[model samples]
Target: MDRAVLRDDMVDSLEHEAKGWINTESVSLAMRSVPRHEFVPDEQRAYADCSFEQFGTRVLAPSTAARLVEALDPTPDDSVLIVGVGVGYTAAVVAEIVGDQNVQAIDITRRLVWEARNNLARAGYNGVLVDRHDGSDGLPAYAPYDRILLEAAAIEPPQTLLRQLGASGHLVMPLGASTQRLVSVSKDGTTVDEFGRVAFSPMLVDGEQVDTVERNRTVREDREFAARESEGRHGWEQHWIDWTHGQKH
Candidate 1:
């Protein structure tokens, strides 16, 4: 099927089966207009409800994107800041609602940033800004976005992103480490609500390095400790020889 036909089919599925999942017309319209195929390589299966993974990034599933857009409730005049422009699919959809120039998306991966930028421009959303930078730090160059949506789940809403919200804006994201919730925080930085539980990739930080001497601990931490700090000390040189020889009194 052609892109238009495929796009329509995808939107229909979302509207009908998504049920109470999608509650806004703007998001519905975005689902209708944005051509998802152009952003991913699976042209034949672009309209599938499943996410397509590529280059360490995955285009979010249709249902997940729709729910996020619904929560954000963007308008034609709104400026939106989107964290994680994985493959530019979600950004393109948001651009359809809030004119292309009004959307700014960032991804920490340089390759994904370049790819998303090129994909969006090719799909006629050249006005959308896709940049490579730390997502948790927030893109300050375009501060005060009317709405912010994070595609990746974070332990908490980054204070930086919360601070960038306009006076009356909404910030939504899948938040948490073990259990995730689709959370919405108001601009004043106080009012918060949860849409539902969700599963998402952990938010990534660009150029982040942990101190080898001590890290909270992941599998990588133990490995790094062994490589950098293990087998070294107890202060007493004689103590080490006594312990190795099993001579404890």
Candidate 2:
């Protein structure tokens, strides 16, 4: 299928399905301008009809991503913090919404960051900046964000992220261990309120030291024997679970 035709079909189908989920002319334009196929690997282009991807599934489904952007209600004045920033597809879409100058894209994977930066440049969307950092740990130097969007999910909102938001600023993410929600947290002084249930990828920090003390708790169980063959502390055996736990409280 022709790529533009496929892109239009996805947007049209999503706009129809997301009647209550989105309503912005600019967003629709962005959907059209951003070549979704460019973000996906060559083999997966055929599956663009589906919202989720089997591999290199960086971009969210059109309707879901559209809905998330709608939830954000981004403006020219808004300074955006984009977590996960997978392949920079969503960031490019958002840059169109908020204008390129106001958007900041962050990801923990160096290669992904490199890819995202290149993708943005190749697509002619040069305003958004991609940086390598743990998504769970928001960039502090650029604190007081007017809007923060996590393409990934966290068990709970990171406190540091909350502190980084400008008063009345909105930060959205998926909350929970297994199931998740697309939650929006609008900060008010020390108080923040949340709403919505949106599923997303798990939040990941670039590099965090393992809690050897915490790991030793399982020494009495066969888990200690299980740990023997593996590299100590920060091995892949426990990285995902540790990442999940780190995002909590």
Candidate 3:
């Protein structure tokens, strides 16, 4: 089949599955217009099933991306700050919804950032602007963002990130250590409110530091892994290896 045709199919699937999860008409239209498969790696295009990838890590399930977009509720008028810039697919997705000029995506990985920029341009989104930077710090240059979306989960809300959001701006991100919940933070001056929960991969920082928060989170996550291991005591030991889970972290 032609790649273009396959891309069209992916869009159709996104529309079908994203129906109720996403209620905004503009987002629906953007999803239909953007060819998600085009942004995905050619080798993995076979599974262009609405998922998110983190370089070599686990490919986040498509349903998760669908839900993330729903949680974000991006509009054409909103200026979006996208972190965890995976392969650039999510940025492309955002560009479709928010317009190329309104979206600004960033990632820590240099190679991934290059790939995202190239892929986005290849997908006819040369107009979409993206940069390579530390995801944890957020993009200060683009201060006062109307909407902020983090692709990775963090143990605690990054105060620095909130500082950059414009008043009344909405930030959709995953919070907590191991078990993450997709949260939307509505900025009101110095105050921010968080709501909603969804499982996601941990956000990556460049430096390595063993601190209280990191240590506690590691311990908690180890416990979660142990619990899952005990539950599958009698099952195939190999089956315990969750490829999907392994890919995200």
Q: Which candidate leads in lDDT?
A: 1
Off by over 4 Å in 2: 1-3, 17-21, 41-47, 51-58, 188-196, 208-249
Relative to the true structure, how large is the alpha-carbon lDDT of every model?
0.79, 0.69, 0.67
**Residue lDDT tens for model 1, 1-249:** 578888887778777853555667888788888878788777766788887667766667888888888888888979999998888988998999989999999987778888899889888899999888777878888989899998877665678898999888888988765688898988665637788889877676655322123323323334545755545654364343566567654
TM-scores of all candidate predictions against the true structure: 0.80, 0.73, 0.72
Point to the candidate with the largest TM-score.
1
Write candidate 3's Cα lDDT for 71-141 as tens digits.
78877768888887666666777788778888888876677778778888888888767887777788888
Model 1 misplaced stretches (Cα beyond 4 Å): 17-20, 208-249
- Local lDDT at 97 for model 3: 77
Tens digit of per-residue lDDT, candidate 2, span 172-202: 7766545666678866433244446766655
Q: Please list all clashing residue pairs in model 2, or write none if there are none.
A: 181-197, 181-198, 182-197, 182-198
